[model samples]
Target chain A: MKEIVKDIRRWQKQDKKIALARVIDLDGSGPRLPGAAMAVTEEGEVAGSVSGGCVEGAVVLEALEVIKNNERHIVSFGYSDEEAFSVGLTCGGTVHLFIEPLDW
Target chain B: MNRKPQKDISIFDRVEELLNEEESFALVTVVKGPPVGEKMIVFPDEKSGVGFEGSLGNSDLDRVVSRDARGELTAGRSGVRNYGESGEAREETVQVFVESFIQPPQLLIVGAVDFTAALVKIGKVLGYRITVCDAREIFATTQRFPLADEVIVEWPNKLIEKIGQTFGPRDAVCILTHDAKFDVPAIVSALATDVGYIGVMGSRKTHEDRINRLYEVGVDDEGMTRLRSPIGLDIGSRTPEETAISIVAEMIALRTGRSSIALSETKGPIHD
Candidate 1:
């Protein structure tokens, strides 16, 4: 969040609807920690990252849904739940992310 | 929900303002249960009791979340916590995410030498608030260390005395001044603080001589162990830029208690 605060403010000034995704929890060897964040604009622009390129594309898709529906919820990705989700972390670690619209 | 025209500033505006000011705070948001997306900002306040702004639906939940948020802020951690509606303890009806925004750790380099310039650049890349201090005003000028956050023209010991209390496990003090007159007092003063890493740069001969001087100044065996004389790892770094990398690498290894060896040679967890 600190690293992308400038980008977030810039998009806000341009009146671009944005969605924020933050890694709220992680287990095992993860590339990023809990506070890792990523912000995606409604125009498909991205700033910051919540993972090591493994789950960011999925997170962007989730952010687009969050922006459209204005919903706040959690999304988990990892090899542990490979049966539940197609995308999983290559490092075999679980990461839980909360995606929400930037309206608040 | 319908798209509404933007007219009023939201809580995010306040978040950006606080972040730009480099103030430490926490953002608590309800991610699960009723009233999802509700938020409250918690920070230290002189007037208000808990320094809470905004709400998480109700006052009871606000009070409970604010208290836990303060704890998370102090530890510089962020995660989701479970709670019952209206702040009950036994139930997991509500889940709130507590995101803490902490100030960056500090690095004090007590020598405005050639290596200081390289060090400041590397420290900035590592997200540390770098400060270069030296007794010589000309050497400690900002022009010499443009990357440093602050350049203090003061005696190393005097500067340490002023800001030593703020040093903690995440902070570091590097005594790059080889002169005993400056480095000795700087080392002694740094040892008195809780600063995690104290690295003094010098040769083997200089380290031996400095040990005698340190013993004369009452630095016991325990205090001697805290000092990383002949600073930096044995990376065969001859250039200042490479030496700076070695020094910062040593600092990270010290904090993480790693052996500073090749990861392939080790057989344990790579990260904690």
Candidate 2:
């Protein structure tokens, strides 16, 4: 979040709707820790990262939905998903992310 | 339910202000249970105790969460914590994510040499707020080390004495000034602080001589243990850039308490 504060502020100044995704928890060998965050602007601009590029595409999709619906969600990704979520960390770890609008 | 557009702007504005000013704080958000999406900013205060800028609906919950939030802030960790309704412990009713915004750890380099330039570059990559200090004004210019967050022309010991209290286990003090007049007092003052890594660059002979001088100056055995004389791992690095990598690698190894061996050579988890 600290690294992307400038981009976030810029997007905010333009009054662009943004979705923030934060890694709230992780299990096993995760690349990033809990505080790792990523923000996506309505214009498809991105700032920061929540994973080591493995789950970012899925996160962006989630962010788009979050922006469209104005709803918050908790999404989990890992190798253990029986539903075959298509997106998973190659590091064999589980990461729980909270996706929401930057709506306080 | 849609949020009022104006509410988010103010919260984000405050967050930007705090982060820009490098003030440490925690943003607590109720991720689950009642009052979901409620947010609060917990500020560390010495006089009136930890201050709260927003509410999590229930005052009791706010009080309890604010206390726990401060603990998380001090530890520089962010995570989700579970609690019962109204902030009761041992019950899983509410889940709040406490995200701590801690200032980056500091790296005080007591020498504005070529190694200092490399160290400043590497330290910036590692997210350390670097300070390059030297008694010689000529060598301590920002032009010499443009990457350094601060370049100060002051005696190493004097600078350490002024800002030593801020040094902690997460921070490092690397004395690249091998000269006895500078390195000795620098080590003596650095030992007095809780700085995690104190790497004094020197050869084996220089380390031996400096150790004797340090002992003469009343640096005890425990203080001697704190010094990483002949600093950096025994990687046989010769170039300044390679030496900088070795030094920073040693610091990470010291903090993680890991043997600085190749991962292929060692067994067990790569990360703790």
Candidate 3:
């Protein structure tokens, strides 16, 4: 979140809508910790990151949806040990993320 | 649960203010309980109940979780915690992520040596507010180590006197001064503070000699144990840059309480 402060302020000055996605929890070998965050603008620009690269695309999709619908959600992505085909961490971890609009 | 939100401060607005100011705070959302998505932000203030927002459905549960959340925020740690609907001990109906926003940890490196330069660079990469201190005015200049956040040409003990009170469990004091004249006072003063890692660099013989001096200065067994003389892990690092990595790795291992073996060599689950 600190990394995107400048960009968030810039976009806000331009009156652009913004959404924030934060990794609230992780299970297994997460690339990033819980506080890792990212921001997405209405124009599809991005700053910061919630994961190494594996789940960032997914987080971006969720951020866009939150901006479009004005809804907040806690989204989890990972493979269960029993399920081999899930979008698990490349390092084999599960990450829980909270996606919300930066209305505040 | 009918309390009004603070004037002009929505829950989100309050969160933004907390984050922007780098104030240590935690946010607790009742993710699975009766009032899902209802949340409260918690910051430590001796004046009880002043900075809280929203509430858990049950007063008992809210009180317990609020207290626990403040503890986590103070420690600058985040994790999921379970609680009963009324914040009882037996039930697990709600899960709250006590998300703590804390200022970055500080790294104080005494003696602006080559190792100090490397440590400052790597420490910054690890998000530490690096301060390089040395009595020699020529060595402790910003031009020598541009990466350091502060360069002070002062005796180590005097600098510690001014800032030691602020040292916490997450901060570090790295004594790169192998000389007894500097290392002795630096280690003595650092021992008096609560800084988590106090690493002193020296050879085996030099460390032994320094131990004698440290004892002469009235540091007992308990205080002497706090120092990590011959600083850094046994990675056989010869270069200053590699030594810096080893020191930072040791610091991380100490903080995380992780076995400093190769992760691949470990047998059980990777993250405990």
Candidate 4:
């Protein structure tokens, strides 16, 4: 979150709606910790990260969809999910993310 | 910065300020429970919070997360915690992520020796704020240790007196001076602080003589017990760079409360 704060503020000042995705939990041998964060602006700008370069592309897609639908909720990506989510961590660990707008 | 914003700043405002200033803070959010999205930002400021942008539906959950957030801030850790709907401990209903943004730990080396130079380089890779101090101005120059964040040409005790209060459990003080004149004062002042590691660099005979001198200076048994004389693990490092690695390995072992042995032989949790 600290790493992306600057990007969030920059996007906010530009009046670009920004979505914040934070890895809130992990199981087994995850690459990143719970507070690892990523920010995506409406203009498709990105800052920070939630994984070791894996699953971030999927996260950005989810964030964009969340912004498009004006929705706020939790998103999970891992090898265990049966839904065949477009993104999965290669590390064989679960990553739970909470994504929302920076409106607050 | 754009009219400097305004008063009645939001939590976002405070978060921006704290992040820019590199001031440590914590952000607690009730992620999965009653009142999701409730957020509280806890900065180090004693008088007031930067701001609380949102509230959990339940005040009880907010109170519990706030308390846990401060604890995480102190330890500089981030993790998920569980609580019951009524904020009871050990319950899984409320999932709060206590995220702390703490500055890096500090490492003070008293000697500007060849070993000190190597230690500064290694410590920088580990994200420590390294300070190299020596009474000799020629050795304790930034030119000699460009990797160090600070280089001071002053007696060890005087340097510690200036910044002793800043030494906390995560900080370290290393006395590589070998000579009794600098090592004694360095060890004594380091012992006076809450710094986690106090390492002294010396051979066996040098350590023995220094210990006797320390005893003469009234350093008691309990105080002597904490010093890591002949500093570093028994890695048999012959070069300055290798010795620096051994010293840092010992510091990491002390921080994690792990025995300085092969991890493959250990049976318990690897990171606990």
Candidate 5:
């Protein structure tokens, strides 16, 4: 979230609706950690990231719903682990993200 | 549960303020309980109950969750925790996300050389608040180290006296000044603090000679044990940029208490 502070504050100043998606848990080896976060504006502007580019698209959609419905959700993206055994596999990792409107 | 929010200070604004000011705090949010999305801010330095702002829709739940948030903050961890709605144990009626926002560790580079510039860049990339210090004003300017959080023109001992109070296990002191007159005083002052990694740049022979001088100045074997005389790991790095990567990698390995060996040599799970 610190990486997207300027964007968050910018959206806030511009009065743009925004949602936050944070990686709350990890089931296996992954590039990002639990505290990794991504912020999305209502119109699809994004800052930061929740994973190594795999689940971010899905998280953006989820964040859009969070902003539209004004509801919080724990959305898990479970990736296939078989291919991850190969060396230099960057995307096959599982992450649980908490998506919520920045209402508070 | 009926408490009012602070005047003109939303929890998000407070969060940004705390982060910018580098204050250690935790943000707690109820993700799977009544009044979901409700949030609270917890400052671990404050007393229980008094430390919290905002509510989790119940007084008892707020009390319990805020207390646990402090524990999570101290650990510098962020995760979801289960709890009963009324704060009872061994129940999962409520799920609270405790997100810790600890201050970044300080990286004190007691040199103003080309390696210092490289280190400042890499240290910032590793999320360290870097400070480059040297008595040479010509070299210690911000123009030379634009990435450094602070560029101080002072002797190592004098600078340490001013900022050493906050140096702790998470902090690191890298003495890139290979000169004996500069590196020796830097090492001594760094030893005075509890800064975790003390990497002094020198060759094996120079390190041996420096050790003799240190022994002469009363740095015992215990103190000598704390020093990583040749600085970074044996990665055979030749350039300043490569040396910076090796140095920060050494810092990470030291902080995690890992052996700094390749994963292929070990048999355990790669993640751990």
Candidate 6:
């Protein structure tokens, strides 16, 4: 979150709608910690990351939707999910993320 | 930069300002409970009492998360916590992410040896407020330890007594002055504070002799247990730079309560 704060502030100055995604929890071995964050602008630009390059693409897509709807949601990706998420960590860990617009 | 010094600042602006200033605070955001995405900020150590803003839907939940956020801030940790919808003791309805942004911890090195410069350099790399102190005015100088944030020429014990109260569980006190005349008192005064790490640098014989001296000063078994003499891990580091890495690694392992073994020998979650 601290690392991506600068990007969020930059986008805010340009009046760009930004969505923030942070890894809130992990169930197994993960490349990142719970506080790992990524900020995505409405223009598809990205700053920081929430995973080991494995699930970040999916997170960006989720963040784009968060900016579109201006709503928040808890999204997860991993092999353990019963929903059979399209992306999973190569480390075989489950990452839970909270995606929401940086509107507040 | 656009924000003026006034009330009614948005939470997002205030958060960016506080974070840029490296202030200690917590941002709690509800991600699971009703009315999700509700957020609040907590400044636990403000003089006027707990400073807070916004809410997580319910005043009760806001109160509870604020309290927990304060604790997490003290521990320098960020994570999600569960609670009942109305902030009950053991319910899972609400999950608020407590993001703590704290100042970097302090690293006080009580010895102006050549090794002290190496430690100070590594300490800065590790994001610690490095302070190098010694009674010898000639040895303790900014020129000698340019990387040190502070270069103080004072008796080790006096130095610790003057600023030891500020030391907390996140801070470290490393007595690199193996000379017992300076180190013994430094260690004793350092023990008076609640510093999380107290490492003494010396040879095995020097360490054993320092133990006797510490005991004579009435530093009992409990106090002795906290000291890490012959400081650092068994990494077989030869040079001062390598030794600094060993000391920093030891401190990290102690803080994380990890085994300090190679990843190949370890299993389970790599990041916690």
* DockQ, all candidates in order: 0.71, 0.63, 0.39, 0.36, 0.63, 0.67
What are the Cα lDDT values of the candidates? 0.89, 0.89, 0.84, 0.82, 0.86, 0.88
Give the TM-score comparing model 3 with the true structure, all chains together: 0.83
lDDT of 5 by residue, A1-104 (tens): 78898998899899999999988877777767877999999999999998778778878888999999988889887754564442322544567888998877
Scored by TM-score, the top model is 1
Instruction: Say which prediction, candidate 4 or candidate 5, comes out ahead on TM-score.
Output: 5
Q: How are the candidates ranked when ordered by TM-score, highest leading?
A: 1, 2, 5, 6, 3, 4
TM-score of each: 0.94, 0.93, 0.83, 0.77, 0.90, 0.85
- In model 2, residue pairs whose N, Cα or C atoms come closer than 3 Å (at least 3 residues apart or on different chains), thus clashing, are none
- DockQ-based class of model 4: acceptable
User: Number of clashing pairs, model 4?
Assistant: 0
Tens digits of per-residue lDDT, candidate 5, B1-272, equal 22346878878888888888999989888778676788888887663335778888889998888889989999899888999989988999898888899999999999899999999999998899999999999999999998899999999878987889899999999999889999887788889999999999988999999999999899999999999888999898999999999999999999988888998888765565
lDDT of each residue in B1-272, candidate 1, tens digit only: 11132237588887888888888899888888996889888885424554677888888898888888888888888888888989888778999989998888899999999988999999999999999999998788999898899999999999899999999999999999899999999999999999999999999999999999999999999999999999999999998899999999999999989899998988876667
Model 2, runs deviating above 4 Å: B1-9
Candidate 6 lDDT over residue span B130-243, tens digit each: 999999998999999998889999999999999999998889999999999999999999999999999999999999999999999999999998998899999999999999
Clash count (model 6, backbone only): 0
| Model 5 ranges off by over 4 Å | A12-15, A79-93, B1-5, B47-50, B262-267
What CAPRI class is candidate 5? medium
Against the true structure, candidate 3 has what lDDT? 0.84
TM-score of chain A of each: 0.93, 0.93, 0.90, 0.91, 0.86, 0.92
Candidate scoring better on DockQ of 2 and 5: 5
Interface RMSD of 2: 1.3
What is candidate 1's CA lDDT for residue A33? Answer: 87
lDDT tens string, model 3, B29-72? 65555655667777776365465667766778778888888888
Q: Which has the higher TM-score value, candidate number 2 or candidate number 6?
A: 2
Model 4 CA lDDT for position B152: 92
Q: Is candidate 1 or candidate 6 better by lDDT?
A: 1
Order of the predicted models by DockQ, top scorer first: 1, 6, 5, 2, 3, 4
Colliding residue pairs in candidate 1: none
How far off is residue A79 in model 5, in Å? 4.3
Query: Which segments of model 6 are wrong by more than 4 Å?
Result: A81-85, B1-7, B45-47, B74-77, B82-94, B143-147, B266-272
lDDT for predicted candidate 4 compared with the true structure: 0.82
Off by over 4 Å in 1: A80-85, B1-9, B44-50
